[model samples]
Target chain A: MRVDVRALGACNRLAERGAERAADALADLTGTDLAVEVTGASVASGEDLAEAFAGRESIGVSVGLDGGLDGEAVLAFDSQQADALLSLLPGGASMGRSAVTEVGNIALGGFLDGWANYLGQAIDMTPPRYFEADGAAVLPDGALAGDGVFLFESRLDATTTDLDFSIYMLPDSGPFRDLVVGKTATAATPGAEGAAEGTGDAGSTVVPYESLSTFASLAKRGSTNAADNIGMMTGLDTTVEVSRLRFVPLADVPAEVGVEPHAGTVFELQGEPSGYLAILFEEESAAAVAASMLPTEPDDPLGDMAENALCELGNVMTSGFIDGWANVLGTSIAHSPPEFVHDIGSATISPIVAELGRRQDYGFVIDAAIQTEGVQAQCDVYALPDERELAAALSRLSET
Target chain B: MSHPSSAGGRDASGSARRVAVGVGDLAVVDGDAALTTSGLGSCVAVALVDPTTGARGLLHAMLPSADDSQSSRPSARPAKYVDSGVDALIDELGAAGASPNRLEARLVGGAEMLDLTAAVGPRNVERAERALADAGIPIVARDVGDGVGRTVRYRPNGELAVRAADGFERTL
Candidate 1:
């Protein structure tokens, strides 16, 4: 369900007021000059929540809501930013848990209190739960069990300490949408015009899911190319079993693929319509693939030769993925030299997810799962388009 | 091997009931039953059992404490936070005919899992330990720390079996 522009604007104002109060509370508590800015707001899904925190490691403090509202209010800060905030407290470095807990209690509590006061409703908030992990780990299971979430994301700048922090409010979309739309439905017709005017200059537009099929088809073409290349390189009969372009919650990517450590190649997209491309193989599958690459050294421990083979494999595979996208969208996209990382799938992809999440609510993932005959080996190829570029590409397609 | 009234037939043995405690959840089971909590990454699951009575309770707490401004607000889910969750589990176990004096606690989970800099596992373990100590409940055994998620199963015989993601099973 699409959130009307009027509802988004109202929530934005509500969130801005909340952020101001939270900033004041933080300043009073820490004895520092703090400025809070409501950077942007959106109606996001559970997947969006996951995507927002994708590969970045942070401290997340979530307080659940009860009574009139049902959802969560989350305040997240990067580890460095958290330390910066903590260092400002009395003996903050040593005080750790209690200090962080108190900060979350005040800041997020104030934000929720603002919403409650504005709605003229009594909302009971649960005590904050502290999680120190990537976004997916911090979010509880079933967070996306509902339709979506209303996100009011803000930036808190501690002027005295030069620290910047992020705060997010994820209210249950059903209740939040009802509350905002109910209040503005009568005046929203005219406000819609105003919203169009406001958004016109920003040039930010939501690309519908149907249009993303264009990217999906391009991804399939790339995967087919990758399969053919794999067959030629390893003499293994490879088939692309699953290929699709879909919007997934950033946090859910690692979980989608098992969280186990996987040997993979990471490549950055450069030039026009840039993003990231990852070629990951499950541990056993990677070992098998690496072994298959060099028949002479079958017992190798995926050393330099195996890594180089994987990188070459990645280079060929990514060319297949990106070239198709560029051909379809009529944009030139260049990929950097492949960098190999053998780490947990989540840790490996978190940074890319975090970057994309920061720009947009939903992360568009072009995924192709390939299976090789006679070997229990499978490879996953991911093509992540930069949010803005994908939007622009889709806008161009619409225009054409 | 099946009772006519046995719905779903998941309980073919018909002797033991399996109680699943989800994240931010708590449960007390007595008689022939088992308490289980799965996919515990950075959360701690505290299992309290009376060996003599076979009365048990499990709590899967996410956060360290509940000393926030909203702690005074009624209707808060006690199992969601460590401090209150431990207390609530003890109270529930007591109500389930488990004596507080004879109650022995076993802690499982609280693993870092991911390679993030912020280590919540140790902190969660510490908070649960502290809460148990404050409540005067002696911790008999624990399988905590390490960077791996765990699935804990507490049987009626007071055997707490902890399994890692790699299929390694250890009984505490």
Candidate 2:
């Protein structure tokens, strides 16, 4: 099944609209002005999702949907904000979890209206389930560990108060897959027609949504290869810690990489889906890793010999990284000679972002973190592919 | 005095309230608060200050022009491009009780941190300069166009500090 390139974007709009209505409903219930800060749909592993909420304590309510769409929705606020919201209710501090649950039920009603309206059907929702615990525990037990799921997340902030809320929608795999792959069917569903009309761009390429997951797995394989190459060259035990795909605005790339000084190598990929790849290491980690590859300890860890050693390592890792995609595409992918760079983390990234920004607004960043066991060495790998080309390549995958 | 406003956070160097401008974002502040942004490479951060009213605005722009990028989204951020970002900063500072005639621009960032074929740092700097000149704002101070990333802190009192990754710090 082929999916329109605009399918994901249309889904993002639906998520944003739902969040906006939910914010309004919450405002009316609590008389506190609220604004939808940001909303998007991302594909990530349950482990990564759980890791995102590891530290914060949150309170909110969750509900399951049965009709029109099959999935679960969660509305939560930080513990401090929950306390402030509790004081706003009629029962004040006495209402506690029930008050939050009631608000969740109402706000969720507003959230589902967008999806139901678009689907041209009625959706049934289960009773609200109140939760007060660590943010990770709030998700359903099945969503805490293994497979990747398509998640819609929206954040809302109160304009006049220091409170914020996050809404997470986890649609069951079947419905979510059908939503994106709808266009390929001879008979288009109401939801698919709406998505096509919402984008107003029909000439673009379409690929099966399932191919996205396939590509994500390809990223996981690339990281594993890089880890093996690191272990071989440095004689250090290396493991792939985090591997995930992030879809974000090209403009946000620099800030997301952050402000720390880094030492690394950059390469430009040349193939079906031409793109860029960067292997960045913390300053100290770069020094240590570079030294490990050399027979003798160099006077300056980052000197010419160390730089050359690092470059060779990056060369082999780059080949190992893109080899998977090449095999999947049935075409060879070549990369430029590694360019050694030492600068602030974001600085090394923004140049590539600007280059990609010339033709694309959003990027699918395949990122992975590799760490040396019992050592301070950590390497961050980022691969950004041209969206149009990627869609074309993935469409070929569905054909095969 | 610690006002503890929701819009501000603890400054990295002191107790003063600070608003951080992210990539392709902008902020305007009143009174004695600080506006800061970090890890600027090819992106340019422009600060427009009106010393008379102590009102200031900062813009962190990633590209030279909006035409250079393909953004199909409806809410294309104005601060993502140098020309539009400068215009937005000027309008915001004006709304914050700062007179347009008295605005002075201080520029930081725009570094070619990597030797890529299509260098954008110089183009971003050039565009920012032209944008400010067209807005009739004087270029009072600037730290631009090098091979290093920089962090910037701008105060309403016309103090701008630039810190590079190589331990170089200067006040403009």
Candidate 3:
């Protein structure tokens, strides 16, 4: 089914219902919900919600929620976890595609299916897509409106591993529902004023999920999170899938100009003159990736194909990370293109090397290991921080 | 199993032990040989240890070389910037006759924070590589670059185990 105007209206009401249902579901899933005192919860980032999966890696059945906002869901499982989750299935990764997609299809199906049955509203859902990483840059645009976005999140500890999902909804305030239900009295005359009145506050226009509690006046639960309804949890929501976006371009460089002094460059944090840092993969991995890419190896090559792939892979992932940071924080930043290096001799590295070695100023560091179809990539991210935001990230649990 | 810490013994004759330091800011000692440094990322860390005395040191760098010179002690600040940090390390080790020939090294970090068209992570990592190559020390082991931030540790005696995105740590 597709999302139509009437269907959109129904989806909106169902999403409203979800808010109320989410709070209760969370209280039940967390077991410690009574201790889970709802903080003011004025704001939360997609990253904060995503990071919830750190260290707890055996998560299968990835789920993505692309509703009325630019938010996503990611659930990854290790190979063993994937195998067990897809028990009695066919062969390897390829054979498991349908089985994995089924997980998301079922999870989403449960939500919409239950909503349609309970509210008797005609809400439709799109087929779930597989996500390797949290696609912050590719999130549906123009999905949100107004100010005061609210972010609500909950975690569930299932039989073996844990499961979690965040529902990001925007409150498009209007008097339509009230007018339709209240003014449509028997023998009552129609009034244009009643229908035209609007909650025109700019904040009221684009309410974020985190700020939903503030908009409790307008926003309500959209669908009930199937916490108490464990019977409905029969839907699938676990699997591991991988997608690699590689740019294959064949370019030749002069043999004389072989040294690419600036081949692998990454992150550019903002400071006075300039501030930046990048890690260069040792020569072996560069050679490994090159061996996989090239048919023949030449002496003193212009640039190793493996190094190029490795660096560019870093570039894409880091670029995507920057975009994710900007989108979630609703901020903007500039960065340099990535460069690669081979046979870079070892040297002692110091923290002060980047920030000029002063503890007075320190940046946040993120170390992650990324595994694609045939490549293993490692990268780090740093973001300078101060008070409020710092506290939040330190408090973030942001991957799932 | 982890390597045994043989960084015992104090200042010795010309015989200095080999050391590969990890991520962190502290001096490591293995007999008389000593190296000091930090890893790089959007955040930087340095490692330092002595081979003759089995001492080492490191510091992870974050900002550029200039910011570190903001107000730190002239000598104390050199080991902070990539350019001067290496110089300071060499000079400090030189006090014990640690020559370029006897000195062997390994480095890590300098992962970027943002990946704009002209980010700084690559630049910093590049400069560190260039500076070290010019200094004549072959990099024994390193897990650095565009991918992920690493918490690299150094072993002054054997090889430093690098634990990061990849589960198994390797000695470099």
Candidate 4:
């Protein structure tokens, strides 16, 4: 075969959430669930190859019959898609074909397996073909003469990686079973054209992730237990972990955010840029947790169980930031807390919020991940910069 | 990744022009056109355009080539990996009137998303640059293989500027 060489990489990224995201993106794009096939590929260059330079890469691919989906085809992406897949990688403007190769070797394997199983077919695939060019050129020019095509494209908002896949197939599928059948198969059948595409969080993803600020005046009593109160209001399981919640001067935090909590009964800490948390459990855990907390009956949309957990989680966590902050600033300010957002891209949680609150003179931001019994939750809290109070606090923050 | 910000706040002229790339994203600019992208970290970015057509192309890659033992799974999207993704970008540029022999190449990205544990970044950079070179396309300039992430931009004529950034930015 006339293979065009681009870059090469081993499947070292096949671990933890890195592996899961690859699997999920694959399933979301190809309509099939995937499992990891542990294998390794080593590289030749280390000294010159150690850095993020051009003209070098290392990633691998292997094919097998998970015997599930009807048809399976992998479409390796360029860095453009890699840009979309990794939360930290930026847009396509900077990367090369190598990044896409890694995405292809590691992430594409999961997607292919997922789609093959989704189609309920024993999928036999060729060894991967790597090169330097746009992916569309290698479309089954001759092989797809009779097969219809299922072009699935997915994006990872965090990595800016693109998991774009196209399966050349016959319109009708002869089932062989072994797919994700049972319940999820029926639900995930994306009945439409063959353009099977969507991030794992595509469904119900339109839930607006707007960054908002609500103002609340401190109550007369100091021990209002507002953070815990938010837990009650939202009805879910949550915790308030504080490394150092002591009352201190306002100048401790970064100056870019102008808000000096010391002026308002709130202290601050060393938050570099932003931070995050992970949220995941399952439905049973959610029900148990909800049963113990929510005053209302916990019988709603099964999916909402996680949402409930997340809302309270958001409320409680932000309340922690508020409580700790209030002590630092030495003022009692009320809070209009953050709403919980579920099925979110864990990587983009901060970027989305930072994108929104970048210009605002906010006091603090608490990025939280509420793991429910089943569904995942990503919630964040942006301390609305109190303008009048902050004007006074800046002078204090600046004075050594 | 470099180029901490994808869309830089408007310059005094309010004209958005520069070589800033996003992850898994691309920009097509005419010969006289200008484009910019965010930097890349471990991800590898490939840029190839026809000087005659001014058809600019850029692809950020993550792994190496699609044919390597590391990339034997044929069910992957070709554009999703360095091996295949670079192919996808080359195909795109070719369609835009870029002759394979006439295509110029530049690379960025492939940062160490993790610490010093793998060769994904280097592999990506090496594969893409080598492939284009093997095809007789010259890589005029490149900024690849930095432990930190980068943001890169490219002018259709292959004028690129890159910035390095730490921390992270969610995909756009």
Pairwise TM-score winner, candidates 2 and 4: 2
Candidate 1: tens digits of C-alpha lDDT, residues A1-400: 2223324544565676678788888888888877663234543345545654567888877788877677777777887677787888877889887788788888987777776776667889788788887755554444555434445577777765668767766666567656654554433232222222123212444443334435445655677777787787778787664423444433334444445767778788875577777788877778777766675775466778888878887887787777777777878888888878665554455445434433332344554556666655577766666655766776677567
User: What TM-score results for chain B in every one of the models?
Assistant: 0.87, 0.90, 0.61, 0.72
Q: Quote each prediction's TM-score.
A: 0.43, 0.76, 0.31, 0.33
- The alpha-carbon deviation from the true structure for residue B59 of candidate 1, after best TM-score superposition, in angstroms, is 3.8
Q: What is the interface RMSD of each candidate, in Å?
A: 15.0, 5.5, 19.0, 16.6
True contacts kept of each: 0.00, 0.60, 0.13, 0.00
Which one is best on lDDT? Answer: 2
Best by TM-score: 2
Clashing pairs in 1: A47-A249, A50-A251, A51-A250, A51-A251, A55-A350, A55-A351
| Tens-place lDDT digits, model 4, residues A217-265 | 1111111353455456655434432111111111111111111110001
Per-residue lDDT of candidate 4, residues B1-172 (tens digit): 1111233233223554444334434545554445654424455778777777678877754446545522122422344356666667777677667788778777766554332124566666777877776678787767666455455556444566565553343221
DockQ of each: 0.01, 0.32, 0.06, 0.01
Find the 10 residues in a row with the least total lDDT in model 4 chain B. Answer: B1-10
What local lDDT does model 4 show for residue B4? 18
TM-score for chain A, candidates 1 onward in order: 0.49, 0.70, 0.29, 0.26
lDDT of 3 by residue, B10-128 (tens): 22333554332222223334443534222233444434343555444454434445543443223222433566666556665566456555566666666653334234556556666
Native interface contact recovery, model 1:
0.00
Which of the two candidates, 1 or 3, achieves a greater lDDT against the reference?
1
lDDT (C-alpha, whole model) for all candidates:
0.65, 0.76, 0.36, 0.37
